[model samples]
Target chain A: MRTFSAVYCEWFKLDEKRYLDEVKRSANSHSPFIYPTMELLNENLDNFINHQEETVISFSQLTQYLVMKLAHENELKVLLDGQGADELLVGYDYMTGYYLNQQLRSLNLKSFFEELLTVIKRKNVEGLQLLSYHFSPNFLRKKILYRNKKYLSNRLNNIISQDNFYLSPMYKSKSLTTALIVNVDYKLEKLLR
Target chain B: MTFGIETRVPFLDFRLVVYLLSLPDEYKYKKGTTKRILRDALNEYLPELVKQRKDKIGFASPDFKLLKELDEKHWS
Candidate 1:
């Protein structure tokens, strides 16, 4: 992962593994393979859950929370995060789907094919998956993916099946501009919180 | 949010975001490259390796391996 490699790019007195381990530990005390016991993991999970006051299956926020905790411990009272660039600039790899869809809708064959070939060469199957997801209906896609165990916990899938919960403004976006705007209004807003 | 630290995001400034949003799509992504303008604008300040790097990993931890090693009972 680029994050792991970025750690290696820095000057370090310790060996690579040790340096990474230290970095991970600083970000999250219960980072896997760094701590010797599960007690810290359980304790941190409970602490995170209580502090967040919401149900979240994803632990990505916990990693960030722990990083802030580290900052707090070091007496750092303010931090500047590079968080909104991806949503604003459409910098994420999966975002190719939105861009490609826009190009196809506008009948920009040259741009579409050019980008498609590059994505196929670089990302292979993952690029194809992004394209399929963009073209598919939101509910149908979630149903198929959940049935195939591609994502979502079984309990959450059951809840989804029972409710009308699949609608998102993002699926209706007809251009990359609209998609970026939606992401900023919805996804990035959550992250910035 | 409860760590008593104030977090700021300069990129999310309304003025900057509005400006970026107004740009054409190709300005953000071209061919296979993402963040086209950012890379181009920061080309001089960024190292060659960073400028050329395609892969980006954002605030991600090794959660899959950790969950695999964790006991199933932990979830219950």
Candidate 2:
């Protein structure tokens, strides 16, 4: 239940006072806030790169590494985070834009899917290319049937017997379903990597 | 896993993820607000200031600035 935060100096202006104050206020009852200085972070990153023989690491990766190090040093064996919420909830502005654009053209599923495909290709984010297939109802149906042959075969009987099952709202809209599926696929690939 | 400290994401919990994914697009993002559902759900618990904050700085660091300074100092 402990919370750890890395605070930057005022010169950075990245950590606003309001956000930091809120973070401090929300700390768990017994949790201590750990603030690692920029110099310490730099040293840690340098040491990590030298030890691992890596030339570069992303800012996010570096931050995670430092947080993990701090947790290990503090003897905190486990920590809970709020990751993956962004992907699931469309927290990214770009994702929101994509979803809204798709919704606007919901009347024509084909053109909507085509436009989405074009956008995905233009953006060229990983695992997005696979998303195009899901947009095509025919392709998705075939893929699902092939991939879940046993499940599909028993779906008829299960549907008849399972009275408590609830269909997700995502299934009602093709665009939303595609967006969620694509996001999940992209996140899964990132996690695997 | 690199530092031997295990980090679990509760947001990625199976049931929670399913429910969140099922929400309408507007619930997720509306107008200019992102994570609308999360903000609303935590509004009562979180400070009003925090709830109203709009900035989303993800893993931002000043190391780049430091590096630039060092480069300039050395070159100059």
Candidate 3:
């Protein structure tokens, strides 16, 4: 129910002036706007490397740390975020491209699935089960041969399943319903928690 | 976890998430528009200008500009 606004501004860049202007324009939309000054730059830099020692600090992580620091200073204990909506809603342009391409390029399913499996193999060590499911000759043949409405429906299900292949090592279940549940329970819940 | 401040994501509500996931991909994204369903759902409640805005600037900060300023002031 409570809404808070904050803006981090730099007095230098012309492009960032637009960002500052936008923040100022939207200031009235939320209550208690908190402007974290440039003076905290050194403190934020110090905090970034204080814990991990060797970990590289990304810009987003630094911004998050600054927000947390500001919240602490203001004595605000809880903050509400709008995370997990993007992943669930396919809000990212890359994901949209992936889904649209997979849907339109049915003829290239074999090579596409193979490339995906290869990437998964290289990036992830626990993707063996998912790789096996996609790499099976029998499954690939059936998926390629079947061209009915039922097959299309199954393909959609497979797409969702493939999207969630990295949720858990035990995520071998092919059911879309179960996959959705697992994604919500394991991934989204873990993030929000 | 470092800040000791609790962050809650209300958008990840179980029912809402289930409904979103169950909806077709077209409903979620359409013609390069992201969060289409969310925009459509909140169309009536939000201001017309707010609803019409397209860009999604997510928690952006001016850290780059700050760093540039520091570099010019101290290093240069």
Candidate 4:
């Protein structure tokens, strides 16, 4: 499937901007999913979007990966993964655990090991990296930072269904947008042909 | 693709962008993430049965309950 993927590389390029925008905006913003893998996906998106107009394969390592993925599966779908600094070190899972527990922030996230994940990646807040020391469980400031009641609420409501008491007119506008994106991308794409 | 690849998405239809983008950015983020809007939307589309469903079966638990009667010398 190397040739198949290669044949579609240009198509991937054409759609890359829309896909990249969605992936980055979704992956970068606070959510319940792992970021590093999302990040790796984002980086591959760079080969499509950065517009440097250079070779897609810049080094021997990438060439070897493509070749191996092609020969083994005859389909190049062997799951090229970043493996782990997260699972091994527990980063993405931390943020997810926090996000889940945020529904009831009184519930703690320190005691589960179902999924291996990394820390909540830091993003620039004005200019500061807001999450640099966020994972230290016992650090007072870090604890206060990562466990903020405000952020916890946001992350919880982001993933879980609402209790319906709070579904106001304002909520409908936002819901319409998400509903619109999902239907357009996943449903309508199938029906168009 | 042979027809010069002119593509158009209906939901992302220009008329839609004109209406939505002109609205407030406040609709995007709140407290921390986009959950409020998303949940409200899902509640509308998914049936109440689906919206209320929450049961998952898993085997990832520690096996002590199953292993309590197993012989330690079995491997030998």
In DockQ terms, which candidate is top? 1
* lDDT ranking of the models: 1, 2, 3, 4
* Winner of 2 and 3 under DockQ: 3
Candidate 4 iRMS, in Å? 18.6
Model 4: per-residue Cα lDDT over A1-193, one tens digit each: 0121111123222222233334345445321221112223334444443433433222222322323333344422332222221211112211233222332233334522211122222221311212222233444433333332232347564433242223222212223234233323333333333
Q: Which candidate has the highest lDDT of all?
A: 1
Write model 2 residue lDDT over A45-79, tens digit each, in one string: 66667654543323455666776777787888878
Runs of candidate 2 with Cα error greater than 4 angstroms are A26-38, A50-57, A107-177, A189-193, B70-76
Q: How would you class the docking of model 1?
A: medium
Quote the true-contact fraction of every model: 0.66, 0.60, 0.53, 0.00
- Residue pairs clashing in model 1 are none
**Of models 2 and 4, which has the larger TM-score?**
2
- Which stretches in model 1 have alpha-carbon errors above 4 Å? A1-40, A124-127, A133-140, A143-153, A158-167, B72-76
Error of 3 at A184 (Å): 7.7
Better of 2 and 4 by lDDT: 2
- Where does model 3 sit among the CAPRI classes? acceptable
Write candidate 1's Cα lDDT for A10-117 as tens digits. Answer: 232211444445445444543332221244566688788889897654446675666676667666777777888988887777677777777888999998899888
Taking all chains together, the TM-score of candidate 3 against the true structure is 0.56
**Candidate 1's residue-wise lDDT over B1-76, tens digit each?**
6889898889988899899999998788887777889999987656565567666545544454446545554664
Please, what is the TM-score per model? 0.75, 0.63, 0.56, 0.21
Q: Give the 10-residue window scoring lowest on summed lDDT in candidate 4 chain A.
A: A1-10
